[model samples]
Target: MSSKKGGKSKFLSEDLNELLNESQFLKDSVSNKKITKRQKNDVTEEESLAKLIGQYQANSKKKKLDVNVEACKESRQKILDVMNNQLETRKEKSNNLLKNLSEVMVQLEVDCNAMKDNEKKLEHLTGAVVKCMQQATTAHRQKLKVLKDIHASFKKQCEEMEMDHKTETDKLAEELEDDIKKLQEKLISETKRSGWENLRRTIFHAMQNDF
Candidate 1:
């Protein structure tokens, strides 16, 4: 009985020691696994911090680019507005120039028409003057011919009157000369007869006285 008890006690002691050794091994394994998991968690935390910093920098650059693009859009809009205003001004100027040219053309056409009318009037006046001058010349020529004919007739009548007056005076002078000659002969005969009768009377008277 004593030996059996001793053997049983020995067996119990061995089993207790085996169980304590297994407990210790399990504790060590759990401790080692905890350290490995802690190391992995530390590495993951470092990688996460680095990725967050890089993302922050990239976001800042993107915001700056977006601001620059917005400013460019605003500038482009202002330039377009200025160009539109200039185009409108040029169009107005061109329209005014065209209107002025049209007015000038109208005035020139009116002046041309007036000049043509004046020219036609002048031509008519010239023709009237020429016709009047021709009539005046013809009348003057006819008057000169009539005066010449009158002068020739007067000269011929004066010559005929002079010849007739000379012939009548010569005939009267010849008749007067014949009458004077006959009267002179008769007077001489009478004077001689009277003288003979006077001589006879004187002789007869002397004889009577002597007796």
Candidate 2:
């Protein structure tokens, strides 16, 4: 609304300036001289009367024109005064709008700073999460290595136990074969001694072989 009023006021001011110039031109035209010479001899009364009437009409027109010019000048000044007032009001309104816009700009700056801070905080949080993930991954790797070592140790113990069992069984079998050969020689000698001795020797040989 203020802009509209300002536009109208500016146009009115321009028109008044133009009208003032026109008024000045009309005043100049009214005051300009006309070149004329009166015939002193044989000038008829009718010609004089006609000339006077013409002068009167001319004067009347000039008076009317002067009055119109004065009225136009006054009207133009009134319009100018009104335009000046409107311009002042518009200027004040424009100043107020500029102040409001400046305040809004300040608020926007603050909001922008807040957004930057939030972005910084988000970046920090992202970095922390990444660090935590890295720690977890490292810990998992260490734990996996420990578990692998434990499994390898248990497998080695099982292999050693199996080798020990095989060796012990072979040694026991050899010892049993030696004891059976000794018992067979003792029974053959007893049979030549006596019948009773032979029976005793046979029982002794059987017990030795069992051992």
Candidate 2 lDDT by residue in tens digits, 1-211: 5697567556656755665475456534533532132223214533654475556555655665566556655655665566557656655665575566556555655655565556555555777765665565556555545655654565565457546645654554455445444544443333223333333344344334422
Q: Pick the candidate with the highest lDDT.
A: 2
| TM-score for each model | 0.37, 0.32
Q: Which stretches of candidate 2 lie above 4 Å from their native place?
A: 1-43, 118-211
- Colliding residue pairs in candidate 1: none
Lowest-scoring 10 consecutive residues by lDDT in candidate 1?
190-199
- Tell me each candidate's RMSD, in Å, in order: 89.8, 70.1
The models' CA-based lDDT, in order, is: 0.50, 0.51
Predicted structure 1: clash tally: 0
